[model samples]
Target: MQVGIFQTQEAAADYAAAHIIDVVGGATDPVLGVATGSTPLKLYERLRAAHAAGTFTLAGKKAIALDEYVGIADDHPERYRNVLRTELVGEDKTGLTDELLFTPDSSAPDPQAAAARYDEQIRALGGATIQILGIGSDGHIAFNEPGGSLVSRTHVDVLTAQTRTDNARFFDGDLAKVPTESISQGLGTIMEAKEIILLAFGEGKARAVKELVEGAVSAKWPATVLQMHPKVTVLVDEAAASQLELADFYTERWNARH
Candidate 1:
């Protein structure tokens, strides 16, 4: 794992975006595993800027969403699929057609069956070439909340109270409107990605960032599972990296590399 503690969130996004552009440009057929929420908004913006500048194009690349809310209308503005479409793709965005963005079917009659088919689709694409992730304040990644099986696959998982509260802002700050469940990619599935880029910012994420970078690998902190992956880049601002005991070491290494 490479931990990059940047002075600001924008700097971190710049680094992450450059790495993503390189990965996508180098791959013959790149499949991006993307995340939703506020933390990744800047990164997506950088990617769009890069594309507009002709630095790299995402025209034919495939993008697989990490999770989607269950029990929400397909047209819900806060739905993961709709969020990705507005933020990353479409005629006015990154130019990737709607057909290229694959998301779990949360509206299906059988959500479990939809999840299974989503997993198969990922496998058929030979897994994600690079996955962009954002850690929840509770250390959950892609809605694989704490205490769940670390090796589980695509499946429906209940969202914790903390998660729902955190996501309430997306639902107009109405906690009751937030979906209580979601179809999320399991740690086992995320681990299959050839590379991973995790972004966390703000003081709220400090403890989780510390656990993910310096604590033991355990299901209790689902983000910690990434510690076992061979190629993982953790990018954070000082506030988010505040709890990391080895912050100086990570900073020293990153500085020396540059």
Candidate 2:
């Protein structure tokens, strides 16, 4: 795992975007596993800017969402699919095409079966070449909340109370409106990615960031599972890296590399 502690959020996003460009540019047909929520917004913006500058293009690359809310209309603004469309592939955003962006069917009659099919689709496309991730304040990743099976596949998961409260802002600050369930790629599925880029910012994420980078590998802190992955890059601002005991070491290592 490579931990990059940036002094500011924009710096962290810049590093992440450059790393993504390198990976995508080198791949024959890159598959990007994308995540939703406020954490990745800056990174997406950076990517869009890079594309507009002609530094790189995402025209034919495939993007697979990490999770989607259950029981939401396909056109709902808060729906993960629509969210991705607006953020990464809307009409004006021409880098990634709409036809190639994929998300789990949240509105399917049978959500579990739909998740299974989505998992198959990922496998058929050749697992994610690079998976983008964001850790929840409660240490969850891709909605694989606390206590979820470490080796599970794509499946439905119940959102924890903390998660719902955190997501309420997206639902107009109404906690009750947040969906209780979601179809998410499991830890096992995410681990299949050839590489992973995890972003976290703000003091709110300090505790989780500490656990993910320094804690033991356990289901209790799902993000800690990344510690076992061979290629993982963790980017964070100072506030988010506040709790990491080895912060100086990470900074020293990063500087040495540069």
Candidate 3:
């Protein structure tokens, strides 16, 4: 794992965007696995800015969503698909076509089968160049809550109380409206990516960031699984890196690289 401690969120976003652009520039046909949530919003914005500046483009790129709430309507504003559309795929952003942006339909006749098929689609596309992830407050990645099986494949999983509470902010504070389950790409599925870029910000994420960067690999903290990946870049602002004991070492290493 390579940890980058940026002075501000924008700086971190900019730094992360550079790596993503590099992947796009080199790949013959780039495919990305994207996660939804506030943590990655700034990174998506930075990518959009790069597109506007003519530094990069998503015209021929394909993407797969990391997860989706199990019972939401496709058009629901809070649905992960719609959120990605409005935030990253619309007019001036990623500009990815509907055919290239693969997201599971929660209302499908056979949801589990849909998930399995989604995984196969990713495999057929030659896997993701780099998956962009946002760590949940409880250390969950995508919707794989704490204690989830590390080698599990794409499937349905129950959302933990902590995860629902964290996601309730997107449902207009109505915790009751938050879905109890979600179809998420498993840790095993996520590990298939050629590389992973994870972002975290604010004091709320400090403990999770600390565990992800330094703690032992355990199902209890799903993000710890990244420690086993061959390539990973963890970007966090100072507040989020506060609990990491090796923060200074990471900083010095990153500084020397420049």
- Candidate RMSDs in Å, in order, are 0.8, 0.9, 1.1
The per-residue C-alpha lDDT of model 3 at residue 60 equals 72
- The TM-score, computed over Cα atoms with residue i paired to residue i, of candidate 1 is 0.98
Per-residue C-alpha lDDT of model 2 across residues 136-229, encoded as one tens digit per residue = 9989999999999999899999999999999999999999999999999989999999999999999999999999999998889999999999
lDDT of 3 by residue, 1-258 (tens): 899998899999988889898898788888888889898888888888888888888887898899998989877999999998887785588677777888877887887988898778777887788899999889999888899899878888899999889888998999999999888898998999999999999999999999999999999999999999999999999999999998899999988986
Q: Is candidate 2 or candidate 3 better by TM-score?
A: 2
TM-score of each: 0.98, 0.98, 0.97
Full ranking by lDDT? 2, 1, 3
Q: To one decimal, what is the Cα RMSD in angstroms of model 2 from the true structure?
A: 0.9
Q: Score candidate 3 by lDDT.
A: 0.89
**What's the lDDT for candidate 1?**
0.92
Off by over 4 Å in 3: none
Tell me which residue pairs clash in candidate 2: none
lDDT of each: 0.92, 0.93, 0.89
Worst 10-residue stretch by lDDT in candidate 3? 90-99
lDDT of 1 by residue, 80-177 (tens): 99999999886456777789999999898898998899988888998899999999998999999999999989999999999999999988899989
Candidate 3: give the clashing pairs.
none
